[model samples]
Target: MGKLRWNILGIRGNPLATRPGMVKIQEKNVMLRKCWKTLLIGILFTLTLLIAGCWDRKEIENRGYVLGVGIDHVVSSGPKGLYDLDKTPQAAGQRKYKLTIEMPKFNKQEASKEVNKGQNHLIWSGEGESMFAITRMISTKTYFSPFFEDIQILVFSEAVAREGVGDILDFFLRDAEMRRLTRVFVTPGRAEDILKAKLQVEEVNSTFIGKLTANTDKAPYFAGKAELGQIAQALRSNHSFIVPIIVTEDKEVRLLKGAIFNKDHKMVGEMNELEILGGKILRQTLKQGIVVAPNPADPQHTVAFEIYEKKMNIDTSVQDDQILFTVKVILIGNLGENMVHEQDAVDPVFTKAVEKEIAAEVTRSIKAAFSKQQQLKADVTELGDLVHRQHPDYWKNVQDRWDEEVFPMAQLNVDVKIQIRRPVITH
Candidate 1:
C-alpha cells in the first residue's frame, strides 16, 4: 500500500500507533479516567455503609413509653424515698421542678402464682432545675429509656404554673418526640397526685383522664380542652389563655373551672365555676350544660334548661382610644326538668317567661366573668384576638400593652337571649 508509510524514530510502520492486542498512550489515558470514576463510586458506597443515621434508635421491646407527665413545684423537702411518685426535693428559696413520668407495665403471660397482681404502672420521677436536665437524670435511677411519643396528658401544679411555665415548655417544644395533642391541666394540689391517684373504672390513669376530657359533655361548661398546641401558641404569642383545672379529692380526679394565664405566661387569677361557664358562653363553646333557675311562673318550683347550641357575636371597637366590646350570646336549649308541668311546654306565654329567666342567669354569669377579667387585667375572653383580626392597624398599636394596660380599662357590654326549642321529660 504505497510502499508502507513509515515515520521518524520508528523501526517499522506505525510504531506509535495502537495495535489490535496492545494499548496506545491515548487508550491508557481513557482507561485511567474510567478507573478513577469507578474508584470514586466504590468509595462512596463504602462510606454510605459506615454512616448510619439515628444512632439513638432503640427496639420497641426495650422502650418504656411515657403515658402521662406531671410537674409540680416543691413546697418543702419531702421524705426521701425510692421510687416515690409524690415525694420531691426542694430548695430553701429557689424554685425547683418535680417531674413524674408514668409508664404502664405490661402483664407477663406466665403460669407462676408469684406474679404481682396489683399496680399496673411504674412511676418514675426526678427533681432538677430544668425539665431537660431532669429527663436525662431520670435514666440514672430507672432501667428503661423514657420515650415520650405516647404521652397523652401533662399536668402542672398551681405552684409551678404560677411561677410561669415558659422555662418548662422550652424543652417540650424543642423535642421532636413531644406530642402536640397532649391535653394540659393545672392542679390545685401536687400534680403528681393526679398521676398517682387510683382509678375506679379504667385501669390506666392516663386513659381515664384522656377519656374524661374527651367526653367533656359530662360537664361541658366548666371543662375545657386545652391541647398543648394551643398552650404553646399562646405562650409564644405572649397572649392570655385558659387551662382546665384538675383537683384531687381522695384519689379521685375531678376537672373544675379554668385557670387563667396572663401575658407573663403565669397564672394571675382563676375563674370560678359560674365565670368559667360564662366564659365558655362568650366563646360560644358551651355545648352541653344545665342552667338551673327558679320557675318563672312559680317562684317556689324549680326549672332546668339543657343547652344544645350557642351562638355568640363579639362586636369590638376603639372609641376615644378606649377598647369597647359587646358580646351578644344566643342559646338554644330544651326544658329538661319542670316541677310545674301544668304549664304547657308549647305555650308561648310560658316559654317566653322561661326564656326571660334563663337570659337573666346568662347575664349574671357574663357580668361575673367580666368582673374577674377586670380584676386579673387579662383578656382570656379573646377580646384582643378579635381586635387583631378585624382591626389590624388598631391592634398593632395596642397589642403589646393590651393585657396590662388597655384591656383592664376597656368597656364591656353583655346581652343574652335564650330560646327553648323542645321540652323533654326525665323520669
Candidate 2:
C-alpha cells in the first residue's frame, strides 16, 4: 500500500510476478502435443506393416482335397494272423488295415478356373499298423497338405468289417478335420477295389459312388443310408449297425446287399433287398416301397401301389421266461397301376382287398427276416436292447447267454396297416 506496483505493459498488475512458472507450463503443453503426433504416426506404421504380410494365407492350389477314404485288411502270415505277442490281438493286428486316400490331380490352372477340366482323380495308398502311421507316411510323400474336410464317403473292406470296425474308426473320430457327415459303406470284396474302380459315366470313382448311394432312395428296398455319425452311434449303442454293401458286376458298381454288425463290430451277416426292407422296419427307419397286390378275379394280373410314407414302431415285453416282440408298421400310399384286364372304371371294393394283400406282404417279409436271424444267430433287430431295457433284472441273469439262448427263442408279432390316399386317374 505504501508503493503501488504496476506491470511493465501498464495495463494491470505485475506480469513478472510468476514469469518462470508460466514459461514452464507453456513448454510442457508444447512437448505433450508433439508426443501425441509421434504416437499416432507409430500406430499407423504398425497397421500398414501387418497388411503386407501373408503368414496365415493358404492357397487352394497348395491343398490336396480328399474326397473318399478306403480301408482294407492285409493278410499276413502268422499263427495268430496279424497278431503280436506284446499287444492285445485286436490292437496287434491293427497294422493289417491299409488306408487309401482319393484325391483329384492338382492343376493350378484348373483349380483357378470356374470349371474343372482334364484333371483325373488319383488314389494314394499307405500301409501302417494304424491309421496314424498311414497318415504320417502320406504327409511325408506329398508336398501339399492333405485335407479331409471334403471327404464325402468312406469304404471298408469286407475283411476289415468282418474282423471289427472299432479300430478302423478310431482315427477318423479323433481327427479334427474329418467330417462327421461322411457316408460309410462296406465293399463286397477289397475296399481298394471300390476306390480304384474306373467309372464310365463320372470323372472320378468317388463321386460316382457318392451319387449311387445318395440316389438309393429311388430303389424299392433300400432304407435310410448309413452316415459316419449314424454308424458311430449304432456301434456304441446296444443295437447293431448296418451299412450298404456294394459289389462290382459286369464292370459296374451295384448295391449287392447290406452288411449287419453286432455290438462287437463284427459283420455277423448280410441282407438282400427284401431282407433289408424287413430289417429297416425293425430298425424303425423304413420310408417307402412299392406293394404289388395280385388280382383275386383275374389271378394272372396284379395291381401296384406306390408307398409315399411309412412309420414303424417296435415294442418288446418279457413274460415269465419267454420274450415277446411286437412290430407296428403304418403305410400311406397311392394306387399307381392296374395291370388287370385294362379296366377304365375304378372300383373301391377291389382297393380294400389290395390293402389287405399289402399288409400280408409286409408280414411275410418280416417273418423271412426272423428266419434269417435264426440261421445266422445274429440279433440284427436290436432285440437284445429291448430285452435289457424292459427287464434289466432278467437281462442280468442271461447276459452271458443272451445271444445264444434268449435271442434264438425270441417270438415276433407283426401288424401292418395300409391306407390308400389317392386313386389312379384314367385318361
Candidate 3:
C-alpha cells in the first residue's frame, strides 16, 4: 500500500509583499498551528473512544437470571414476633424477611435430567431486615451472581405481608435492573414453601406459579395478576389493594384465593374466591366467575353459569351523615354445567329462573365480601376511592376513619343482573 501524504502548501504568507524573513516566520507559525490542531483532534478522538466504555454490558453466562423471589418473615431465634438483637442476630422472633430466589440453569438442567432427573432450577434464601440486604446476602450462598433483570415473580408470605410490603417494594422499584412487570403473590403458610414446592407439570416451582398466573383469561376475576409496579403505585397512593394467594400442598403449588392489604399497606385478611367476586364486580374486572345457583326446577340439583361478560356501576352518596354505597353488577354468561335434572338448559322459562337464581347467588356473594371487608376494616373494593373521586369533601371529612368507622357502618346495596344462554347458542 502506498503511503498517503497530506500537502499543506501555504505561499509563505505572500513573501513578495512583506519581508522574506517575516513571511517565513508567519508560515512557520501557521504550520505549527495546523500541526497542533491535528494532534489535538487525534487525542480527542482517542479520549472519546476511551470514555465510551460499556458500563452496563454483562456476559450472559455471568448473569444468574432470577426467575422468582420469595420473601418470608423470619422469627428471630428468640420470642414469638420479638427478638433481642443483643443476644444474636439469628434470634427466633426478630423482624426479618427471608428472601429466596429461583434461578434456572439450562445446561445444568439438561445434565440433571440425565443424572438425578429432578429439578433444573436452584432456590436459595437469606435473611435480612430489607429485601435489598437479603438479595445481596444471597450471593454468599451461591457461586453465580444473583441477577434481577429477568425476575418474573415475587412471593410474599402471609407473615411478611402482614408486616407490610412497602419497604420491600421500595427496593424493587428503586432497582434499575428489576423488571416492573414481575408478578407478586402472597402465600398462606410460607413463601419459601411455595418456592420450594415440587411442581409436577413444570420442573421449577416458580415456572409453574408464573404459568398459573398467566392464565388470567380462565378466571380474570379471581386469578388476577398484579405487577410489582402496580402494587407500588397503590402503596404510593395509600390505597388498599389485593394480591393473589398461592398455597402449597403435597409437593404441589397452586394459586388460590387472594390476600387483602389495608390502607396502611399491611395484609389485614384474605378473600375466598367468592369474596374476590365482589372485588371484581366493584372493580369491573369480573370477567369470569362461576356462579352455582340452586336449580330452579329441582331444589336438589344445581346449575353453574360461567360469567363471560360483567359490568359494574358504583353509585356513592352521603345521606344524613351516612355513607351509602350501591353496587350494580350486570353479568352475561352461558350455562356451563347444568346438573339440574328436573330443569332443561334449553328451556327459556327454566333459563330465566336460573338467571334470577344465579343473580341472587352473585348478589349474596358480593354482600358477603362486603361484610368481610367490613370485618377486616379494609376498603379493597376501592369504594373509598370512588367516594373520594365523587365527593372529595365527604372523603376528606371521613378520610381518617373511613375504614374503621364509616366503611363498616356504611350501607351497601347490591343489585345483580344476569343473562344466560344455552351452550350451543351464540350471543
Candidate 4:
C-alpha cells in the first residue's frame, strides 16, 4: 500500500522538492502535534479537579452530637431572684438555669475496633442566666461544636416548669438546627435525674426515653403523643396547654400523669392515670383500650370490647344566655372477651346492650373529667376555645367572665354510639 502524503495547502507544487513549502509543512505538523498534546493535558487536568476534595467535610468522630438537654433553676447567692454584677460579669442581676447537655462520645479508633465502646455517651453541663446563654457557654467550653440536631429528648425541671416554660422553649424553637419533633418531658423533681437515669434496656438513654414517649399511644391512660411542635403551638394558642408528665419510680422513668396548665405557662394542676385517660377520651385522642361492660342479667359476668376506632365531635349551643356543650363520640370495635351467658354472638339484643354500656362508660368518663376541671378551675381541654369558636357572639358577651361565671356554669352532655365489628373469635 502507498502512504498518503499530507496536503497543508493546494499550492499545486511539490513540497518535498521546494525548500520553503517543505519548511511550512514541517512547521504545521509540529503545531498540530503540540495542539493535540495541549488538549490531552487540559482533559487530564479537568478530571483531576473533578475528583472529590476535603471542603468543609467533618468526620463523625469529630462531631459532638447532643442527645438530651436538662434545664434547672440555679440559686445564686447574689440577690433575690437576681444575679450580682460583680460576681458574674456576663449579665447583671439576672437569675438563670443550670443546663446539662448529654452527647455520645465516639473514639474513632476504638469505635472502629469495638462497637460497644462507641455506644458509650457522655454529658456536659453549664450554668447561665438563660437557657440560650448556658448553651453558648457550653460551646465556649467544648472545643467541638455542639450539634442539637440529634437531640431526642428535652427534660425540664419541676421548678423551671412551674416558674414558666415559655422562655426556656423560646430558645429551642428559634434555633435553626433544633428539631420540632423532639420529645419534651417534665421531670417529677429534677430534670437531671431523668437525664442521668441509667438505660436498663436500650443502649442510649435518649433512645429509651424516645421509645417511652412513642409507646404511650398504646397505653390506656396516655393520650396523644407530645412533640416539640405541638407544645409550641399550644403555648401560642388561645386555650391552655397540657404536657405529658414523667416520674421516676424505682429508678425507672414512667409516664404517670399529665401536667395541666392554665392561661399562664405554669402548671396549675395534674391528672392521675384515670383522670388522664378520661381527659384523653374527651379530647378524642384515645387510640386503643378495653372497656368493661357488666352484664345486666348476670352481675358477675362482664363483656370486654377492644376499642379499634373512635371519633369525637363537640358542638356548643347558647340557650337562655347559657352555653351548653354537647359531645358525641362514636366508637367501632370488636368484642375481645365475653363472659356473659349468651350463645348468640351477633344477636341484636346483645348489640343494643353493648351500645348502652358504651354510652354509659363515655358519659361517666366525660363527667369525671368535667368534675375535675370544675374542681381545679383549670381549662385543660380548651373547652372555652370550642365555645368561642362555635358561638363567637356569645363569647364576646362573656369573654371577661368566661373563666369565672360562664365556664363554671357551662354544662356538658355526652352521647356515645358503639358498633361491634366482630366477636373475639369466629364461632
Q: What is the C-alpha lDDT of each candidate?
A: 0.80, 0.74, 0.78, 0.74
Give, for candidate 4, the lowest lDDT window spanning 10 residues. 1-10
Candidate that scores best on lDDT: 1
Encode model 2's per-residue lDDT on 283-352: one tens digit a residue.
Answer: 6656665867675446588777788988777888878788888889889988777776555325777777
lDDT of 3 by residue, 65-184 (tens): 888988887755645454534522642334467788888766764746642333567778887676776777677676678888878889988887898888778888998999888889
Q: How high is each candidate's TM-score?
A: 0.78, 0.76, 0.79, 0.75
Q: Count the backbone clashes (under 3 Å) in each candidate.
A: 0, 1, 9, 3
Best by TM-score: 3
- Global lDDT of model 1: 0.80
**Candidate 3 or 4, higher lDDT?**
3
- Predicted structure 2, TM vs. truth: 0.76
Off by over 4 Å in 2: 1-56, 75-95, 108-119, 217-220, 250-252, 293-302, 341-345, 383-404
Candidate 2, residue 356: Cα displacement in angstroms equals 2.5
Deviation from native of the Cα of residue 174 in model 3, angstroms: 2.1
TM-score of 4: 0.75
Ranking by TM-score: 3, 1, 2, 4
lDDT of 4 by residue, 369-416 (tens): 877776766677778777778888888898766655678788888887
Whole-structure CA lDDT of model 3: 0.78
